[model samples]
Target: MSLASREALASARERLDALADNTAVDAAKLAEELAAVTALLDREVSLRRVLTDPAQSGEAKAELARRLLAGQVGEECVELVGGMVRSRWSRSRDLVDAIEELASGADLIAAERAGDLDDVEDEVFRFGRIVASNPELRAALADKVADRRAKAELVRELLGGRANPVTERLVLRLVTAPRGRSLDGGLNALSKLAADRRNRMVAEVTSAVPLSDQQKQRLGEALATLYGRRVHLNLDVDPEIIGGIQVRIGDEVINGTIADRLAEASRRMAG
Candidate 1:
């Protein structure tokens, strides 16, 4: 997204932040609204892609967006989408993220009110870092550097042992998310959203191999104790990590892997 578009999205996010107050929103009603917004954004994004493709003319794309959203979208949604189209923000990732924020904010509020949504939000952030840290894996997921099925397979073969059930499912879902824009864009939005759902942040831990069930339970308990609050640990597995564990929570990283130690040694020697 362009800088201008990013600024606009920031503006939109500020507008939506007001709804985050749990007291202001009706949990049940807002959940329904959130669902509606998600569906609307999905359809809008789909229409935007179909319309904005270089293969399709602008007029053709406009007409299509109109037809698809005209009856299906609510009055406010229609106006919001139409404004985006007019502003040429239909293809902007910033705007898409803005829409996602509005929807996710509503979900978070509803979940808070219901008191059932666990700390999945942190897990999502950790998942993003896991993907971003691995060049080959990140390329495969975000850039189609590998075949789709290969990407899916890599998730099973490499990540099977490393990540938690939720993390594994999240990766697979991102790899297979139906494309309106790039799958990465949609998946990234959703992942960040999952993080925003929790009260406490997520810490994603990577291991060379799968941790045993006993280890997982112990590790979770240990982490919760350390943080003085419950924390969700999403597991990630990569053979290249090469022994030990790498735990990442936001910008903080604890790399205990042999590979990392070697890299650190090399850096120190060079300096």
Candidate 2:
């Protein structure tokens, strides 16, 4: 996203956080309404362009959004979308993208309110791993020719009773309507969004053995200190590493495994 879009998205997120803070606002319902708006904007390219037109007055665009959304969605959603149109977007599509993000954010807020956010985060990560290991499933979910309802059902079938409802709904939404993102990309985005709810980073930790509670806590604390942000560990045991652990946060990797050291030594000898 461009700088303008980033600024716009940040402003939109603040608005959403404010709404989420209100106990009276139904986050899930807000999520659905925002999603509907996203779909509408996505389909109406000319309208999206007009709304984001730099030449147009912000207040006018906002009024247009409010009039269009008044009875179609809740007041909260109307206000949110109106606020979005009042801001400058780098591109018309960025406006739609921002609305979609708010939809997901609302769902995360709902999970947080229900005290199921942690479970939802873990479930999202596990589901991503499952998809990574299963090519057939990944292909099916990413299949554009497949019916959206079928993909939704597949997600529910796999996640129902096994994961948090928020996780299930999130996965279903992504699988059914990926918005041109790869499955992996979509899942990673969702995971990051979930983590962002608590202002934390997710560390993919692979160790030679499963870490104990104390070990996990200590590691999380250390990473948090290093990064200056709280870190959530998504752990995996890989005995093949022989010893130590490997931590991945975004594109950065910290490799401490015996296997990595041996490989480095072998390369040095070969040189």
lDDT (C-alpha, whole model) for all candidates: 0.59, 0.94
Residues 58-143 of candidate 1 have per-residue lDDT tens digits of: 46655665666676655434444444443334354445455545555555555555553453344455556666777776667755
lDDT of 1: 0.59
- The segments of candidate 2 whose C-alpha lies over 4 angstroms from its true place after superposition are none
Candidate 2 lDDT at 3 equals 95
Q: Give the RMSD in angstroms, all C-alphas superposed, for model 1.
A: 9.0
Please give, for residues 1-271, the per-residue lDDT of candidate 2 as tens digits.
Answer: 9999999999999999999989999999999999899889989999999999999999999999998989989999999999999999999999999999999999999999999999998889999999998999999999999999999989989989988888988888888878898999989999999999999999999999999999999999999999999998999888899999999999999999999999999999999
> Candidate 2 clashing pairs?
none
Model 2, position 166, has a per-residue lDDT of: 83
Q: Show the lowest summed lDDT stretch of 10 residues, model 2.
A: 168-177
Cα lDDT of model 2 overall? 0.94
The most accurate candidate by lDDT is 2
Against the true structure, what is each candidate's TM-score? 0.46, 0.98
